[model samples]
Target: MSGSDRRRGVIALREESCTVCMLCVRECPDWCITIDSHVERVPAEGPGGRPRTAHVLDRFDIDYALCLYCGICVEVCPFDALFWSPETDYAEPALGDLVHGKERLGEWLGSAPGAAQPDGQSASG
Candidate 1:
């Protein structure tokens, strides 16, 4: 399989599906859920100066590199903005690349949240 066709194993969101409730935003222990919205704007003009198109996703990502997947972010989301999907095919050529940001997690946002993330997280046994 080509690297372009591979998938990420972390969770993310659906913008339209997100109600901007800030549930997941609050519950995230890693402080990873960065949300960009329509509220913050410069107030420019559009094609016809018709109150130019706003609502930009400046940042809506999870640092899978940092994400413990404690599921707190998923549990707190009242709008069902986040979720875990069946796809978990993330492979990184470098350690830095393995860190999943917002764009990558956006694909599988669901309504399911799991248990709390364990503290003192380390990959070692």
Candidate 2:
């Protein structure tokens, strides 16, 4: 397998794929990930069916200042929401700006890689 696809500069988030499970935030040893979500009741499928609750992601932020770049969040994420982005130019002018919001993280999707297979091959391949 070719190693040209390696780009571990920064972590990016795929908001759509994320179920707000909080696994990444909880697994981060540096406590750099922060996620907030709200529960919404989904309508029943049919007559006499009961409604179910779904987690709506409200906020998901990652503070690069405290991040260890350990890739733990990407590994622990069961929903395949996080990935390593080749975007290393996201340097902040201020300390507070280092905390990237969900929108900002999603913007890096241009370079974010697809899900990888166990054999070091992209799932799409």
Candidate 3:
């Protein structure tokens, strides 16, 4: 298969789309993903309504040194916040440098591949 047809690669995360649900952390076979969040109160929609609590992401980090590149984290994310980035040049001189933070992970979004079109379907179809 050609390069475009292959899907295995590093993960790209969208912090805005992530709800800090911890699904990715729980599902990771290598336990490479780490997330920290805190509950925040948001204004209610109507008067006298109770404020809604949401999880505000504080930290999201992935240790590439321990990752197996299995793509399980991407599959378990319900919010579509995780994706496969075609970029493969993330080698680091030290093991500590392999652990990427939220900002670094989000940067990979720019190189992430677009959603695949359905098989046997053309854009004009």
User: Candidate 1: minimum summed lDDT over ten consecutive residues — where?
Assistant: 116-125
lDDT of 3 by residue, 1-125 (tens): 98766856688877877899999999999999999999999998888888899999999999999999998999989887888888788899999999998888887877776522235332122
TM-scores, all models, native as reference: 0.56, 0.83, 0.85
Which runs in model 1 stand beyond 4 Å of their true positions? 1-9, 40-56, 99-102, 109-125
Worst 10 residues of 2 by lDDT: 116-125
Q: RMSD to the native, candidate 3?
A: 5.7
**Whole-model lDDT values for every prediction:** 0.59, 0.83, 0.83
**What is the per-residue lDDT of model 1 for residues 22-118, given as tens digits with 9 covering 90 to 100?**
6787888878666766655455456555443445555676656677768787667775556665456776778667656555665444321331123
- Please estimate how well model 3 matches the true structure, expressed as its whole-model Cα lDDT: 0.83
Give the C-alpha lDDT of model 2. Answer: 0.83
Q: Rank all candidate structures by their lDDT, best first, as comma-separated numbers.
A: 3, 2, 1
Ranking by TM-score: 3, 2, 1
